[model samples]
Target: MASNGVEKVGVLIVGSGPTGLGAATRLNQLGHPNWLLVDKEADAGGLACTDVTPEGFLFDMGGHVIFSHYQYFDDLLDTAVGQGDAAWNTLERVSYVWLKDRWVAYPFQNNISALDKEDQIKCLAGVVDAKVANAVAQGKPKNFDEWIMRVMGPGIADLFMRPYNFKVWAVPTTMMQCDWLGERVATVDVDRAIANVINNKEDAGWGPNAVFRFPLEGGTGGIWKKVAKLLPPERQRYGCQLAGLDKDKQVATFADGRQVAYDALISTIPLDITLRWLGQSEWADGLQHSSSHIIGFGIRGRCPHGLKCWLYFPEDNCPFYRVTVFSHYAKKNCPADGTKLPTLCKADGSGPDSSEAAEGPYWSLMFEVSESNYKPVAQQPTKLGGSAVAAQGTWPAVVAETLAGALATQLMQPGDEVVSVYHRRLEHGYPTPSLGRDGVLKQALPWLRKHNIWSRGRFGSYKYEVANQDHSLMLGVECVDNILFGTQELTLEHPNIVNPRKNLEMKYTREPVMPGLLASAKPMSAQEN
Candidate 1:
């Protein structure tokens, strides 16, 4: 505590998710002792947390896979948890698109050979038109829709790109900007695509997460929980809801009347909310975000999906845009085969044959439904006529809808016994890359930094392209380095440079000698530490 009767630290970190944890980890490793980490939740891992049902089924907040682009991030994971085969499960990505009532190999544009002959011709014709147009193209695309047409043409745009993106973002593609998309969306390679079509082959190997690792014991949240454990317990404070931030005084007041004064602050709170707190609410209008409704079902059956990880849904047959066979990630994700649980309802939303608990050779599916102003969701009422609604009486309408959708998509059979159900609504699910996002960020981030505040995370900086776990963590790590040594924040500034290639410059023990020195810095030798 400071002499002025306010708690004080060299740095005060808000939100103990990957961003805060990364900042804390780097500070601790650098022997910096005067920093404190706080989070509103009782546990860490903000959007990356996991929830376990009463029947012991585990579902992550959303589909999360680790496809790291930095060696420093890999080092942190290895340091937090063991790197051996026992600690992790390296799985091949067997992802597909649920289209025309059939499973098409992922990167739909490249796998048009699976489509009907007439549809395949449409796709091929569009690709030919797109290539011809590109040879003498004009200025850059006006928006995301234009970018799509420029890259893959109208056939794919109408069939998959437009509809699929609208379902995922809950907004029209015209409202989105194209600059944020570098390697995020797969573009067609005309020659290869044509060759594959002629050969009647599938091109399933496209994205960065084609091969990724997951923690064997815990869900995605378990990884962050382990990372938090690496930090000193005394340095982390939970249940500290931030009430106000005084930029002038460099002090943060909690909801409970506690105050923490700091020389610098690293905030992972959503940028819109942060702007509201700073009395700059008007600037928040430039940012657009979509809320997520995640629904999970634990079923009693052998895994029917086999090695399939996730499937995309673009049609209106399902409310969700994506569903993942979450149990396929780890054996511990589902309850033991002998564990018993009752069936809440059938896949068709009908009553089960028996209400009695049954044993499960279990599997689980998690679905993500996007919601925005353009797409509103039907939420169950908390109270009506001054009385609280019963859980059974007021079942979430979305859950029932999702059950029907699962059947419609053939994800669940007619009478598959559902053992457990989980649904969570994340208000700030995805930070959308809207047309005006960059303009707002350019002004707001620098203005906050002038007040000794560094806002960088998934929702913090609002860059969806670099909002993965590894990218989020590195944002914090880079922000800390910028504060301490005036180093360039490549991840924050030039996402294009840091994203497409592996960054091996910053190892765990290696320390930079000067500011603006990344490429010149050498990794510390094995015996240095």
Candidate 2:
């Protein structure tokens, strides 16, 4: 420890994602100016970053649409972009599922018309059986699989829900508990589902994000980037990696060899990473995560598929669970109209050798592939012992896999010129809600708190319910509020509690409140929720 003199602050925030930014903003709002924020990245927006290909095509990590259930979140977004239609595009989420060679209106369990006649009958029969069984059963489902079967029956579960969920979560449904299924899963009504199947009526607009707003520029990351600018520059630090922590000393050390002592630390970094930094290895081992590979493809010409968004690959033509038409969110996401670019290569790295430049408007699609020990990626090696290789036997292998899966399910055509490609692997992409999650958090969080540290965020707290952009931000905001004032840290302690309403008063005209100091040299309001 080369004594740089003790630089103490009221609060020190790690990981400047939405959560960290939220905390800083809230601390500023609460009139607490003695706080510092830092992130490892050059900018904010953790998993919400936008990637730009060499060809000038942009793609978000996956499908990120803004649909807030809290007024506080809404107010922050309005403040970030200013209250106007010009800053955003309010689009009804036109979504679908690709099943049995047809486009089925999403919440696929409700639309059996897309399946074969045999599948349809099997699904209906299962639905009826499930209804009958449910009418006589008592108590709640013990696991997610059981709850899914109870709600959707065997037919729909077998055909869609089970496989699709496994693909998304990269874990078996039986391994997860049912308690986390609030508004996340789409539960289909048996009677309505059967009726719709019988009448062949489509159930299109369903679920939380039936309609959402997208920022006009910079994608989702742009929102938080703008939000970061709203704060006083001196108090924030970006592009700084957190190295370790001296828990007893209440000091956080960064990779640059700088150490900062704090009265209280609000860490939004991954819980496991934080544990490792604090040398708490036992608790770190308990947490689990599924890595995600975000793949983006920019193609020449207008979008061939009429549909705005769709979820595909239940049958394993590809490793991806969902693919978003990223260009649909904003035209500026791709190069301007009439800009010419040459095809890098095909999805399989094979095609006609063309150095000739192509012209006109472009569109892009983003695909998400979940990876874990259970479901590994199948790509080809680019070279010996190199990470740049695509997996072998993956979806890119089959010739018509892309277009057929596209047209047979309706996303694109046979001759859509692919202009650009992008692929990035996020090691801790999603916090897996395994059986051991709750127990680990219970022990780990309190232990850290005893040392004056609060670990929170998507993977930090390891609660998926409050892992979205808005929820993560509120987690930070609430943590600061709890630290500065006696306000409840709703998102951190209770996710469901905060999801239904705004946690704070949203008065735009008035100045925000500030934090007050306390005795014992601790920041006031240090009680944990």
Task: Please give the clash total of every predicted structure, in order.
Answer: 0, 14
lDDT of 1 by residue, 1-529 (tens): 8887899899889988889888887787676769999999999899999999888999998999887777677778877777879799999999999999999999899999999988898998999899899778999998999999888998888999999999999999999999998778888999988998899998997877888999998888899999898887999999999999999999999999999999999999999998999999878988999999998988889989889999999999989999999999999999998987777666655566776788889999999999999998877742211223232233467777787899898999988877777889999999999999999999999999999999989999999988999889988888887878787777888888766633323223334322222333232222212
TM-score for candidate 2, please give it. 0.89
* Poorest 10 consecutive residues by lDDT, candidate 2: 520-529
lDDT of 2 by residue, 104-140 (tens): 7787877886678899998888888888898898998
Assess each prediction's global lDDT (C-alpha) against the native: 0.85, 0.74
Candidate 1 positional error at 34, Å: 0.4
Q: Which candidate number would show the highest lDDT if scored against the true structure?
A: 1
| Top-scoring candidate (TM-score) | 1
**Which segments of candidate 1 are over 4 A away from where they belong?**
381-393, 501-529
What is the lDDT for 124 in model 2? 87
lDDT (Cα, 0-100) at 414 in candidate 1: 84
lDDT of 2: 0.74
What TM-score does candidate 1 get on C-alpha atoms? 0.94
